[model samples]
Target: MATFDEINVDISVVLGSSEMPVHQLLRMGRGAVIDLDVREDEDVSIYANNTLVAKGQVVLLGERVGISITEVLMRSPEIRPMRTDGPL
Candidate 1:
């Protein structure tokens, strides 16, 4: 069996997203704030290796920030199957 300790995965937390014109984006400087499309009470999406794995909430511990996992996402085995058919 292979040990999992040797593996590394990149984790990312997406709170929300926003779209803007290139001119507006280029005009931004330090201390710029781009509003996201999420509310304060909304759950954030957590991704592992660029795949959505779970959802969580943002937390603050002392002066540092953290994430509190509220739910875990699992893949349905029936939905994912090896495609032996010819490519489209």
Candidate 2:
């Protein structure tokens, strides 16, 4: 088995996303703000290697920004509780 410390994963904190026309995208300039689909108070999605792994909210430490984990998103079925007695 591979050690957790030896595993490498790319993490991305998605603030929001939007779709726009090529012309509009090309017209973007400094100080221009593109509206995102997320709300100010909503938790942001955290991805590991492009896969959703957790949810978190943004925080500021002095001048630096950080994310505080709010919830963990699990995708593996093996992590869930198993049924034994009988099938439904």
Candidate 3:
């Protein structure tokens, strides 16, 4: 079993659309462009626990989505649970 401390997953920060009304939002159809609030060519930040961890480029692969890790912001030390055993 893998614990939270034993997992390493790639996370992404997505730019959200602003100034869009919820009523109009409900009318969005396929292929509609919902512009994200980010600049082009800008690095999309990825984080863990509110801490910046990496940056990546968005990519598409055969209708699937992917991210290419560009930089690592921080690499923290591993955490371990307390345990004690003794002869009885």
* Residue-level lDDT tens digits of model 1 in 1-88: 3777889999999999999999999999999999999999999999988889999999999999899999999988885556899784
TM-score of 2: 0.78
Q: Candidates 1 and 2: which is better by lDDT?
A: 1
Off by over 4 Å in 1: 78-88
For model 2, what is the error of residue 39's alpha carbon versus the real structure, in angstroms, after optimal superposition? 1.1
Which parts of model 2 are misplaced by more than 4 Å? 1-4, 78-88
lDDT (Cα, tens digit) per residue for candidate 2, span 8-46: 999999999999999999999999999999898999999
Highest lDDT: which candidate? 1
Number of backbone-clashing residue pairs for each candidate, in the order shown: 0, 0, 0
Residues 1-88 of candidate 3: C-alpha lDDT, one tens digit per residue:
5567888866547543467889988999999888788887777777665667779887779999777889987554554324567643
In model 3, the Cα lDDT at residue 6 comes to 89
lDDT of 3 at 65: 72
lDDT of 2 at 66: 99
Q: All candidates' TM-scores?
A: 0.84, 0.78, 0.51
- Per-residue error for 16 in candidate 3, Å, reads 5.2
